[model samples]
Target: MELKVDVLLTSPQERAYHTAKDIAKLQSLNGTAPMLRNCEGLRSRSLGDWEGRLAAEVRGTPSPPDAEPLGDLMQRGSLGQLLPSCYAAQLLPVPLMVEENAVWNGYYRE
Candidate 1:
């Protein structure tokens, strides 16, 4: 079956943005490709002082002073305010998906 998309939401990071851009090229909504919207909420967590360090080196160490907390990450990633409005507007998903759509990647709900 042909795929459809109403909206393509992605993290502002280069990788996610490019991936979504590629997917947007292959899908269409109302005969037009959807635009890639950069959602800061979808961004990878900020690691602060630990950002450039190797995982092996930082694995068991205490969190850096500026590291984002897991709870904060979850809250931001949830996109609670954004989701309901998008759902109400009947937006489909790329990464953050709606339940009825079968193309879940990292789609968040609630």
Candidate 2:
């Protein structure tokens, strides 16, 4: 598949930079190579006091009664606590499902 991109919003992270470069290459093949830049507003929110901790340790512990609620975060367009989980989802454009008894077929257009 050919993805023609006009612009790409990326973070300062190395992986994000590489991914954007690859996409720009593909776009160049089509015609114009859009500019890729980082935006501070696009950066993910900080975890505050929960930067690094296991799920078990973090759970069952109250958030000091001052932390933002999950629903509130989503309402504010932040996704806050769910950010990590959403990262993987962001890399995936579609869900890939596999079944033992299922057979799939497709055609390669390249």
Candidate 3:
């Protein structure tokens, strides 16, 4: 499906930015590509000292002592947290999500 996207806000990571650029290529406003911006706060969870470590290698490694908690990510789009709590407002995670399309929307009903 095609979407009329005027702007795209992505995390500061290179992969995220690249993905946004790819998506923007498919989006348009009056035949113009969407604008893209990198947001630092929107970055994925920082692995801190755990960067480059394999999950299997550290399955019981206790994680980095300085790593941030996963719950902090919920704050970005949920209750009073640091992630802005506007993920849904931004129409983020957008549409065409397989889990959403095939599982959540496919099974649940009001």
Candidate 4:
């Protein structure tokens, strides 16, 4: 199956940007590459005080008081200003989940 990209929207984070760039490059291999645009709303949710803590330490704890709510983050992705009109876009910050899980299973194993 071929995926068609009109515009490649990405988070400003290094990892996300790089992954998007690589995709853009692959698209170029076949035809004109899609334009890459950084979308702030695509960035990972801020975990507040849990930002840099080990995964095991934060796994079962309550969300931090200052953390951004998941609903708010979802709303941001749908905001008119953040996304172009009549375009296909789905914001999934899988990296956020992967990072913690990878840390738990790889680095902070019990």
Ranking by TM-score: 1, 4, 3, 2
Please provide, for model 3 over 1-110, each residue's C-alpha lDDT reduced to its tens digit, 9 standing for 90 to 100: 55555556566677767777776676543487766765454666767788888788778777686787887754652323211332323433322111111211111111
Better of 1 and 3 by lDDT: 1
The model with the greater lDDT, 1 or 4, is 1
Q: How close is candidate 1 to the true structure, as a TM-score?
A: 0.72
Q: How many residue pairs clash in all the candidates, one count each?
A: 3, 0, 2, 0
Model 4, residue 27: what's the lDDT? 78
- Model 2 root-mean-square deviation: 11.6
**Candidate 4 lDDT, 8-76, residue by residue in tens:** 667767787777788779979999877776767667788999999999999989999999998887676
- Alpha carbon lDDT at 81, candidate 1: 49
Q: What is the lDDT of candidate 4?
A: 0.60
Q: Write the per-residue lDDT of candidate 1 for residues 54-81, one digit (tens) a residue.
A: 9999999999989999888778666574
Q: What is the C-alpha lDDT of each candidate?
A: 0.64, 0.46, 0.51, 0.60
**Which lDDT tens digits does candidate 2 get at residues 1-110?**
75444445554456656666776777688788776654332333345566576768788876745455655544433333222232433432221111122211222121
Q: Model 2 segments beyond 4 Å from truth?
A: 1-3, 64-110
Against the true structure, what is each candidate's TM-score? 0.72, 0.48, 0.62, 0.66
With candidate 3 superimposed using the best TM-score fit, by how many Å does residue 61's alpha carbon deviate from the native?
A: 2.6
